[model samples]
Target: MVSSDHIGPNETGRIRATVKTDGKKGRILKTVQVETNDPVRPLVVLKLRANVIDAFHEKPLQPDAIFRSPCRKCHLDRGRDQMGAALFRADCIMCHMRGKSAPSISSLKKLSRERLKEAIEEGVPDSMMPGFSWRVGGPLTEAQIRSLLKYIKGR
Candidate 1:
């Protein structure tokens, strides 16, 4: 796919590249990246049309990809539900827990809801437990913090 900026359709001063993957038949379908220059009004159109860094080029994620967050391994990926799931899988709690692993969603099932929320606030320091960045810290949003809690609890 291509992103057209103020470069006015097919123009010059742009960058272009092609990506392809091997197919079972030995042939492959390639993804293309063609950028036209229009410094006058370029305005970051690379991502507006296609993210050049994406290897799959809009292809459905592989199973492993589904297990992690696409945006940031350190931050939320999609909706709260998906983001939380990614956090849980990534063992985000261990960021400060040191040698301990993040509580499994199954194990969290045994904890009381009140306790869970409390733990979220007071992270298991030395482990990967990242206190809800939005709660008492800076940066992370409320939704992300909430998602981390929800993900920890396997909700």
Candidate 2:
């Protein structure tokens, strides 16, 4: 909708319009036409294009990157293992939700710490899980991996 169809040059020579979109994902194209008093150029047209998508509230990390470098800056606190908890929430919760593909905390508690660390660092072969170490093309550093482990083990 245009604020006004007619605009005077002395007042405020501006063209303003607004568009509203629904909860649908798609491409949109619109052309707006304006008429002028000039004889040489009597009309002007503007085109607008937009792409809409429905996505998660928080964007996931890149497939090849475990975590973003910027996010690591603020996650330096080691007290209470908050960094580990944050990492798990950001990375693991997707596939390891309760009663989902991954086992529960109670089930994982039976495994030895070394075994759990091995699985997390190396990932199981032919599985969807990916190793989160930079040496293996993952986003986590050694310390971050340890933090994640501590968080998972509730230590």
Candidate 3:
């Protein structure tokens, strides 16, 4: 459904779409044709891709649930006090707990700046810590990763 059929000059448009697979699996691709009255371009195509998995569904994670993991509860309040702190709290704090399977961020003090940067950018092998650098399909930028490193080292 489209919010408005007609779009005015310099105005934005909103569209709400729903696709039902109905128990089908595998990759599904669909293209939506948006008809417009502009002289230069009359139609726009929007491609949407969805992957349907048959098993092992995953739950979405919420940033506000900062204390979902037991270890996060320990530094619950203190963890929210830095630039990268929010980033870390949103992405890392869950798996990288102090006494859990993943080593705590506090232990990163032993690593050199270059090594730490590589670990975040390239990720650890055979480990749960995924790379956060966009170069490797991760979400974090160099500056944001550096900020996280600085936050980890208490600097």
Per-prediction count of colliding residue pairs? 12, 1, 0
lDDT of 1 by residue, 1-155 (tens): 23444554456444565443211123334433343354675444342222234343256433223224442433333233545666455534422234444555556667887777666665545653445444555234657657766665555
- Clashing residue pairs, backbone N/CA/C < 3 A, model 3: none
Please report, as a residue range, the 10-residue window in candidate 1 with the lowest summed lDDT.
20-29
lDDT by residue (tens digit), candidate 2, 45-135: 9777788674421475443332334533222222223357777765666556685667666666678889888877777665556666668
- What overall lDDT goes with each candidate model? 0.47, 0.62, 0.68
lDDT score for candidate 2 against the true structure:
0.62
Best by lDDT: 3
| Model 2 Cα shift for residue 44 (angstroms) | 46
RMSD of each: 13.7, 12.3, 15.3
Per-residue lDDT of model 3, residues 13-94, tens digit only:
8877778764346999878888888778889888888998844214433332333453244434344433497877766765
